[model samples]
Target: MNGLSRLPRLYVDPTLVPTAQKGAPCLLTPEQARYLGTVLRKKVGEQVRVFHAGMGEWLASIAEIRKDRGGLVLERPLRAPQPCPPLPLAFALLKRDATDLVLRMGTELGVSEFLPLVTERTNTHRINPERLHAIAVEAAEQCERLDIPTIAQVQTLPALLGNWPHQTSLFAAIERLDKRENTLHLPTRQVQEGDGLLIGPEGGLSDNECQTLLKRPFVVPVSLGSLVLRADTAVVAGLALLGNGLRSAPVSSQ
Candidate 1:
């Protein structure tokens, strides 16, 4: 039973298993079934962990496996569902590969929601939500996360700022700040749970876009240091700094 933890974990839809208990049948998607049977060569009675964002995780054994379909029998519960507050990371959409990287790494860093923004300089306003969602799911599984992040539909920069909730602080990473504007440097204090981090696309936000963000009371401009970083790099660095703050702060404060 201890070795069951080492088995591959798959994210199952919560709706697929409304009730979970020992010996309950858990169906697998065609892709998951094929991956287990063909790729991993796992046979009936072999163990695997199945999880869901709202239903928690369970250790189960392969009940049956064929070319395109399979099922599992739950052995026991591994963890109970415990959802966290939104860890929103709103970033300008970059190239396909960069955007995928941001979603993957962002999931690993505990981001619970992703808001893709289209700014004046953003290369494109389009994205395949299905593909991006899969990337985040894989990252969550690899990182042993209990939940997957939700990828919001693409939205414009001004629209996001205008509609953002007033209670949540959005840390905007602004580059090339003047010495007198040093107050805009990243804050040293711990960030609250609902707080979010925003990253601009490569070439950074335009002058007009920057001014718009500055005017928003919810937007707090922060410097990611003097050296200019690639868009994807900035997302990772900013999240790391903010995540550190969240981890260090007292639980009651968060």
Candidate 2:
């Protein structure tokens, strides 16, 4: 059997304060306890794979199981803490189901961070951070990801653009293209640590908004083929291309 397939995976809250040594007792949060004891029916002595966003995955054994609380004893380290490739995705906020899909699939696709943007064409400005966090956690657990993607608070597109970092590369998926030659080519060079991909809202960015984005030196307009893709679909396709490129390129030591 594959090594990761051997044990069930669980994402523990780093705020719970787990020590990084064998025989240390790691207390579970109420929710985590309920999940292990009730949902999974985990019993004392059963082994589990546990991980935190700050700390990498570890092998742990169930030490205590109670109605409202549970504990795990850290046994050994599974994977060390390594930085996720800097593939931050800035996407215009979508409707409930569509937003949920992006959170789940994006986490599985290994996006390091997620930025929810309120664009000119966006329908809703509000996003449920708690719900999105839960979705990312569940996706990470199922996909065997070492860490969950950080979900930023909802911000306006203009604000996001204003504060955009200089070192990070940005690729925007544009819907309008007069010629095939106008499509921005995927980076043939090595991807740096903090490259980002941006996708507009479902109805697409307003003319003024598109013009504003195009004026930015860091923003490169890319096309996701000739057809117009839904907001969620564009996220998956864009991240898929970026992820492949990042994985293929050799990491720079500088």
Give lDDT: candidate 2, residue 200.
Answer: 91
What pairs collide in candidate 1? none
lDDT of 2 by residue, 1-254 (tens): 26757677888887664567778778887887888889889899998888876678889898998878988999888888765777899999999999999999999988889999988889999988888999998999998778889999889988998899977778888777445342354343345668898999998887777777777778867768888899999999999888877778786678
List runs of model 2 lying over 4 Å from the truth.
1-6, 179-190
Q: Model 1: per-residue lDDT, tens digit, 1-254?
A: 47765899999877667578888888999999999999999999999998887768899899999999999998898889866567899999999999999999999998989999999899888999999999998998888788989999999987888778999899989887655343545444458898999999999998777777777777788778999999999999999988887888787733
Error of 2 at 122 (Å): 0.5
TM-score of each: 0.94, 0.91
lDDT of each: 0.87, 0.83
